[model samples]
Target: MDFGLPKERTSLKIPPALGEEVQEGRVALTPQGVRELVARGHRVYVERGAGERAGFPDAAYEEAGASLVSREEAFGRGEVVLKVARPTLHELALLRPGATLMGFLHLAVAETGLLEAMAEKGLSAIGYELMGEGPRRPILKAMSEIAGRMAPQIAGRLLEAPLGPGMLLSGLPGIPPADVVVLGAGTLGRAAARAFLGAGASVYLLDKELSALEEASREAPGAITALITQSRLERYVAFADVLVGAVAVPGERAPVLLSRELLARMRRGSVLLDFAIDQGGVAETSRPGIYQELGVTHFCLPNVPALVPRTASHALTATLLPFLLQVEDDPLKVPALRQGAYLLLGQKGGHLE
Candidate 1:
């Protein structure tokens, strides 16, 4: 079988600075990923200590045939820039005009200034979150799986005293387990249901679509599945010890499902983990970091996987490598890549939908 590999490979850059305001330890390309790109004859320039936070030393990247370059050279010389988070304004300024940028560029919820800057630079930007067609989001799925699996542990810790009511997620032999209400029956929700179930919590998974709910039921047999109705949501939210917001809408901001009025009904000291915060969150009160609002502890960090940088970086590398390869030549030729092009060269906004 003839795999259509590009005859002329492109120069790729991996920068050290994370795009988000918060400290993100995960790097876009790992040493292993660089090795594969180099094997295919691509030139890879890695910024010094780019993968240090993710536990991949500079020596590993060097062994993989990546040139250790300064930040300026990495961003200035590459035809394509690979990043883990959306580029901050400072990092965005460093990119050469018309360079292709591939990363988790959440343009839907991005600041207008950032969008304008990209357009002014005439850059081509591809968002990993918006890459695939329905149910085919490889990069998003990998990150969501990591975030979902970590939810139970984070919630369990938050449920302890000082931050919470000092309740155990598993409860005692006679005591009832904590109720975990997971919104959205998508990949993250299903994974969260399984994790919460394993943690001995009573899991209730909800979604607007019956098909998604049915799928979640099959994936997590013991968890209860329900259609998200106003009455049902109110009842569940009122009693929920932990409310997890995993809802998402591809290429758009996450719809606000829980209003302040509804959130106010939750018991004092209850926890709310809004995984959808990256897409503007599923709750009206959810913000882009951990805090207390309306007597509820809210954990709404946009980059949850950054907590486990080593694992997250490796997983990201595996899922992103194939897409990176396809874009080396003509990105628009690939259906997924074309679909993910939020901002095309010399344009302010490409196809968002």
Candidate 2:
């Protein structure tokens, strides 16, 4: 599993930090991951309490051969920095110049200032979302499965009294079940359809690609699949009690499917769960996290899996460990690492563009 890299390239000085203040509940690496890295001769710096929220205590990391250091030391000392979310302004400023930064760096919708700062600092940045070309995004798929499975449960809660019309997702014996319309037929969309169907809701899955629809149908058999068009989208959305926007395009902004006008036509008290918010959202009104507008509940959090931190962290580590092991001083030298990278040595958009 060296991926054909030279012996020296397998070892890296890595720091797994989530910053001084924990913005995300998930940690990039678990204690088990650290132990594996350490056995391979990498120096792992675990920021004090970095994995606490994800249920991995400082003592656990210490026992696994990680040095629990202060936040500043963790960020400043490592040749490569690992994180869950994109770094904040303060966190970005703390990185050592020329250090390699890896995480879910969603650069498409990121601020211009943030991109410029990374360039100025001479950092190499890799995004989890962009990892592996042509539908082989392992990291993105793992997280998307979590978010999609969570959507139905979250929608059920939001559909209760006070927040939404007192309607059950799985209607009573004589009553009709809730109508769930999901946009996109990709990983997240298919998962959502399966979960909602399991919850006893009637699911309608739509995508522009017929092949994707066919695949989703086989995965979630009870779902009613449709080709996305203006007429069909408007029709299904209007009938939806819970509308899920699970649409995504790799390395680009999510396509906006629902306009404000289209959204306004939906029944009052309906719920809109936009899983695509990380890549600019599938609805025009979507903003990060939950909000209320026009009598509809909007849960547009970019990191929905964060709600289940312990589970999310373990899943992330399992998928990310191999990639972390592949990292070398110069990431671009590795083919898989280069595909995932958006910035290399302060320069953006050479291979990435």
Candidate 3:
């Protein structure tokens, strides 16, 4: 993954620092990316199912000089394991002793069981989320940005006819721009703002925090408007052409910021993009679901991230590729994610003797 930093920063000795060192099809490492590694003389192993989603086949990894291995073989041979999600118990048990596992480990909310598991593993477990700033994981934030940007595209597809406030996104002369209300100013919110603005819509970004609101006001211009008031939130909600719910509360279920009364008051046919449906959603009516219907409209589609597999895959690759490089550099220093990383090197069975 591209960590948005220049390659060759001798300061940190991380693998992904090399620019374009890892290409998109690098489940086992593409030939191009692998050739670069081989030139440096590094033996690489990749687990099956790792590159499948990225349009990379098993042959590609083999062609790149990476030994095609099962999860067990890969973890056994690999001193460092880089993963998207925290490894399940099965995944974690496969690692060799002294192996370091790097990925997101969101243990802030007293996830002591996982913490205990890591300690028992006797591996130096580092969390990606903790390595960076507070509460936010950069990789997850990047993925959220992609998800938020896609919200409008999905909304547009769903609302092909009569999209809002009696005006079209590509309005004719005298027609106003579509109204888009983004309910959070975090990564997802800002991404949604940019996406909507690109679609020729007037964006109103709402957040309870002054800092977030201020950031939006300054970073996004023209079509983007930022506000810190809850009073007017309903007014905009009722009149919006699209309501994008990206608000989040981290480990806890996201509170319902938009009430049932307000939802009922919303303009008929206006779309609601509940991006946080997985986190209990930001709308009162939202449930943990892929699709939900309320009165005249549907809301709270979880797994919106899965809708664009190719895009999600690339986004993930861009974000985490550097971490893998970091692992390659030291074969240690497992950085846990800000939240929800489960992989660790040790399990109940015992470490490699």
Ranking by lDDT: 1, 2, 3
lDDT of 2 by residue, 73-112 (tens): 7777777787778877778787889887878888888866
Q: lDDT of all predictions, in order shown?
A: 0.83, 0.81, 0.58
Query: What shift in Å separates residue 276 of candidate 1 from its native position after superposition?
Result: 0.5
Model 3 error, position 247 (Å): 2.2
Q: Per-residue CA lDDT of candidate 1, range 30-88, in tens?
A: 88888888887788888888888779888999999888888777777777787777887
TM-score of 3: 0.68
Error of 2 at 190 (Å): 0.3
How good is model 2 by TM-score?
A: 0.92
Tell me the spans in candidate 2 whose CA falls farther than 4 Å from its real position.
1-23, 350-352
* Candidate that scores best on lDDT: 1
RMSD of each: 6.0, 6.6, 9.9
Q: Per TM-score, what order, best first?
A: 2, 1, 3
Regions more than 4 Å wrong, model 3: 1-43, 71-80, 85-136, 161-168, 174-176, 224-228, 249-253, 296-306, 328-353
Write down the lDDT that model 3 would get. Answer: 0.58
Model 3: how far residue 271 lies from native, Å:
2.1
| lDDT for predicted candidate 1 compared with the true structure | 0.83
Higher lDDT: candidate 1 or 3?
1
Please give the lDDT score at residue 350 for candidate 1: 49
